[model samples]
Target: MKTLLMITGAALALAANPATAQDRSNDRAGDIQFKVLGTAVLPDGEIEQVNVDIVGLPANTQTAASDNYVPTIAVEYFVTHNFSVETIAGITQHDVDAVSGLPGAELVSDAQLIPATVTAKLHFDLGDSIKPYVGAGPTYFLWVSDKPGAATIPLGVTDTDLSDEFGVALQAGVDVALGDDGFGLTLDAKRYFIGTTARWFAGDVLAIETEHNIDPWVLSAGVSYRF
Candidate 1:
């Protein structure tokens, strides 16, 4: 077959060149972008409570949360070509289980949530390599460090207090380009209506209290760089 006709004549000589007929990897007007991600803390099972008293506890005691895989970073600035403003630095880890048909006594806890976000983006031109976006803001959830299980709760607790969350963030994204330099590949999705309020201690005496409403759904992808 003559080597498949010399690979079909080099794909018709690179499709007849001419800068590939437009598609310069879009994003104009003072651009500055960077992204590196791999995260998913999806939890939309509806968690809520504002207060609770513990003393042999048993009054609506229920808690179960698990899902973690983190390592993310984002930065985007394009204040013109359709407006942009993005900032997100992340950290997520959660695993709390204490629900035994009732009467809280099978405790197991862990948490590490450090999130900071400020977004305001709306970009769309759908041409030169595709780029679509939509965003919303305010996400501050930092109540890092917490672990208290006391050997699966035999009473005589130690310490645990995790509370600090101020949320409201919505987003949608797209950006694909792997050619004309400037590198790219991004696909994001976020929805955090946050929640946190939990306390447990025995050394200083303040047994337990609860209020958690972590409505989360944060999915992400990686690789993107443009200047």
Candidate 2:
């Protein structure tokens, strides 16, 4: 929570300064832009639907409520008057659950995910104030720290592994210039079609394996500086 506030404050400080709005030229080739992005992530996919993977266990497990919000930073460098390259980086920690209606039948699991992405962007010539852009690229997800819940220890589910994912990315956004100093506010939406393999443990050993599609849509809003 504190980190989110710090990001918001820094963006506001940069945006509120008069020196940031002095330049209004959006088509300046070779210009470099930096952004502090605040993202609200709603996780939806096949991977998130699975519950317990214990062998010979009763079915009817519900996996839900793992969505989260994340903050990130990005850099954009213009290659031509209307073309640019963009890179974004962020990390998230998800609290997951394996549950059923049977009394006291629940397990908690968590994972850490980091995404590194690069994209080629084409900006529309919409004068100096309204700049709309579209981009497509690739993303690599690094998954780590797949921790099994305490409750699972008694259930013979001892471990888990969430494999890294590779997928394509698509995005669209608009940047609205703030005053004349080149500070801007941006609204961006992106989607990633990432699929991965997961393995679960039973009897303190690897047992169940599943193929999962981690398709996630990311929507973000934030502040940027265009130089």
Candidate 3:
């Protein structure tokens, strides 16, 4: 979060500079922007349903996934002065652990996920410097890799898999132009509604099959260059 704080500070500082907003003539249609950002991926990995639990999980079993911070890159194209399409690229890793009934037990480890998304946004022209926007779009979360946790390995578990799924996301953010030369700073937030199916196997036998709600709130702060 130290990186996030710094990004926020820089953006705020730039916004406070009176000279940065001196000109708004360059802000127009057909512009393409690219950004490098520090992002925080906060997810809720609670078990939502149990399709098959032959492993006999605890009656009140529940789980949680760890939050991760990563670097992300975003590309955006202006369809018009007030509309744009944007997408981001990044990979985040997490560990899921039992939080209740079987407290402290690790269920899955080092799950790497790539959130592939595209958003259509409506930018609200608030003034010369601040442009606030809202967006909604579809997202496909791809589970690149995952491993059985230490606790699961002893149960004769040989493999683990998390199903890739598609979902929707809502976004809101502000972009602050630093100068007319097309440099800016942005702070964006997105809420994703997504879920996945998890399976654990012992050689040829399926030990457990469960469904999970992996709703994640993605937050970002970055420097942008427009062309």
TM-score of each: 0.32, 0.77, 0.88
Candidate 2: worst-modelled 10 consecutive residues by lDDT: 99-108
Task: State the local distance difference test value for candidate 1.
Answer: 0.70
Q: Name the 10 consecutive residues with the lowest summed lDDT in model 3.
A: 1-10
- Which portions of model 3 miss their true places by more than 4 Å? 1-27
Off by over 4 Å in 1: 1-49, 53-111, 114-125, 133-144, 147-158, 161-171, 176-182, 185-189, 194-197, 204-206, 214-227
Query: Mind giving the per-residue lDDT tens digits that candidate 3 earns over 1-227?
Result: 34433544554455456564334565478989999999999999999999988889998999999999999999999987667899999999999999998899999999999999999877664577788777778999999999998889989999999999999887878999997888999999988999999999999899999899998989999999989
Give the winner by TM-score: 1 or 3: 3
lDDT, candidate 2, 1-227, per-residue tens: 24433443454454456454325563488889999999876654333344445465445544432677889888999887566899998887765454353334334366778877898876663565887777778999898677765656676677877788788877778899999887999999877778766677875566656566566778899999989
Rate residue 180 of model 1 by lDDT.
81
List the pairs of residues colliding in candidate 3.
none
Candidate 2: regions farther than 4 A off = 1-26, 45-54, 57-65, 98-108, 202-204
Please tell me which predicted candidate would have the highest TM-score against the true structure. 3
Instruction: Please report, in order, the local distance difference test score of every candidate based on alpha carbons.
Output: 0.70, 0.70, 0.88
TM-score of 1: 0.32
Candidate 1: minimum summed lDDT over ten consecutive residues — where? 1-10
TM-score, candidate number 3:
0.88
